[model samples]
Target: MAAFDELDPLSGRKVLVENNLTFHDVTEAVAAPIEIPNARWWGFFIVSVMMLGLLLVSLGWLFWEGVGIWGLNNPVDWGWAIVNFVFWVGIGHAGTLISAVLFLFRQKWRTSINRAAEAMTIFAVICALLFPTVHTGRPWFIYWPLPIPNQMGMWPNFRSPLLWDVFAVSTYFTVSLLFWYVGLIPDLATMRDRAKTTTRKIAYGIFSLGWRGSTRHWQHYEKAYLILAGLATPLVLSVHTIVSFDFAVSQLPGWHTTIFPPYFVAGAIFSGFGMVLTLLVPLRSWFKLENLVTIKHLENMAKIILVTGTMVGYAYGMEFFIAWYSGNPYEQFAFANRAFGDYWWAYWIMISCNVISPQLFWFKAIRRSPLLLFIISIFVNIGMWFERFVITVTSLHHDFLPSSWDYYSPTFWDMTTLIGSFGLFFTLFCLFVRFLPTIAMAEVKSVMPQADPHFGEDGHHE
Candidate 1:
């Protein structure tokens, strides 16, 4: 072995010994020209158009008539709208967490997934914001939820959970969108350079904001990014915590639990990872991004899903144990009713989808297989929806009074709105895919072995 002084600092080639074998770092892995199956992009485009049309139609209907056209009523007034709101907000968490938290941890592997994940974060937050405002019944007076001057001398209820949600969600969206657009600047410059038409070049050039890859610019850029990521890390945690408070702060038997804050955070990550997997697994293959985003990245993501799913399962177990131990009859009965009551099917579906489905990832074969991961991701999504349903409707349907007890199922309008939300999500995503870089070229380049001269042989110096 060469002594430290004898070795070149410029070529600090350190061998990675894994599984009793040595490996050398090579040139940066350049993403090959993507030759994705034509059908995939076309299919996504078609589906997005259809969904966009549906979303416009639904929004028009909701705007024209009012919230009353839906099934919301007294006692059950916080119906599917709030559930969908929380669900979409939860879905938003994983993106920022992956981008900010993982970046702080110096997880170099995050390069492939972080770009698209951040975009999803922005779009998911947009989907989430629609609910509470529209659910207000008087959609025009949605500003009443904000801290603003009004005709009345009254201030909005500062103590209200919904009020906290308004602040938290808005703050979260602002920060997330900022972080995402900041990251996109370099990539947008790349698109601007590669543009073939005057329109495309001008559009991308403006968005790129005259980025020139200057060392000084990068110095400030990196500093700004670090500060933004630091801000986002805490905000990501707080956003979902406040969302959970919308339920936990309530006196409802099933909703009232101390574990909800962290439990909601974990579930948010779980479901958000599920959505990421659903989008990426298809996208990587469809876009022929195999060299850019390899199987190792997918496997790592699967591992996270497995870990979060287990935590979710443990939370479920704790809720049951605590309900019984608290000696509160209402709490115990609520949990018991969840497992084996009229809506027991929804409860079991939640358990099976969230808990059982993720277990398949323990098998390396399943985790590595894109198709299998895609299927599991869908199951996780379904399970998460039911998890919200089990928490909201199950708790609200049969409350403290037996006389007020009633079964709740979504009406046609409710289903239409739900479907339209999917359309909205996909519509935004499709637009992003067509226009945006999709991959973080600058970030990916930074992580490449070639970027670090110490890792390659040719850069050797004494």
Candidate 2:
């Protein structure tokens, strides 16, 4: 390992040079000062504490009072709970998508945000799990959905979308956590070195698994990460497609469309990118990482959002066109009634937020502006929620019989539970930011132009 002592051509000054540092150097740099405070931190703590209390209270009530207290009835049995489940799960997709897919593409910007984004993925999956787990009424017996034979000799339905969701989501969460944690090991080792207290050192030491910055370790680590990324790309698409199948597999008129898979995948990426932007924009600024993360990273993400948004819009059009072409009066009536019927307001909001609002990003100015990007990200989340609502409630509310048609609304408990999920999300994210290296510093440093000084000989960097 040699230091570059040559004069610089760009600035005509001596280049600052040192022994070439490994990934360990970069990881330590980012993890060293990660404990800074922002207003969002206090807000996150307060909100999370309150939400935790609410979650405890709500769980107690659900157990004591029974599932009857929920707004679910025969026709609309799957209401706010299911909607929020899909919403949060969709939120979970953004993180792994940003980390794994972008890694595969060699997108350098992903390094700045992927660590936190992947952590968010894990937390969002946790929140998503609560819905189905608790909503089962007999939460304990929920395991009957697994393949194990019970005393009654009944097995879980392999054909059921619910079962598919169980396998898909569970596998997705497990793999994503593994990928995220594996990526964090080298960084955790860096933290261990910088740990102020024995406790911190021990904790990070255990997490780091005694990682040493040997060339052999880096070789194995890089290979493992690439394989994990390959595993995750399909998992990302499969999880959401299975989620869509939870609707599409049903015989319900509006829900029976074949276009749901691609549509749902696009919407997942759209919403996922939105959630990533929402987290990173404030995070980069608050952490004083302007030079490291950079505006160009956010701009790249906005372009992704734009592409995904357009795909969602195309899906919407395809759904409409196919509904008309299918010649099923039930399907036709379902789409029409969704737009112009009782829940028309919800439908329009979905359109405006998801389909219309994102089109503004076509302008480079809006795409690059952090403030506008933040606002659009919020819109994307809102629109995604409405998209799930429109798919679930709208289709189910108006089935074949006119008499069975009804409206769905979130009750008091429903509202609390949804908000409480947000608390859970932020709490996990805030803890991750405070404790772990928020940026994948090793990966970022690897891509920086100055990381390799051989550029003068090969002229590859210029």
Which pairs clash in the backbone of model 1? Answer: none
Backbone clash count, each prediction separately: 0, 0
TM-score of predicted structure 1: 0.91
Tens digits of per-residue lDDT for model 2, 358-459: 999889788778899999999999999999988888887877777876777777888888888888888888888888898876677776546666655654
Give per-residue CA lDDT, model 1, range 1-462, as digits (tens).
Answer: 112212223434321111121111111122222212255666877887787677678778878888777776555767889888988999999899889999999887787789889888888889889888777767888888777877787799999887999999999999999899999898788778777779878998999999999999999999999999899999999998999999999999999898999999999999999999999998877665665566667778999999999999999999999999999999999999989987999999999999999999999888878889999999999999989989998898888889888787777778777777887888888877766767787887676554565655673632
Report how far off residue 326 is in candidate 2 (Å). Answer: 1.7
lDDT of 2 at 105: 91
TM-score list, all predictions = 0.91, 0.92
- Write down the worst ten-residue block by lDDT for model 2: 13-22
Candidate 2: C-alpha RMSD after superposition: 5.0
Q: What is the lDDT, from 0 to 100, of the residue 383 in candidate 2?
A: 97
The candidate that wins on TM-score is 2
Q: Give the least accurate 10-residue stretch of model 1, judged by summed lDDT.
A: 18-27
- 199 Cα displacement, candidate 2 (Å): 1.2
What lDDT would each prediction earn against the true structure? 0.82, 0.83
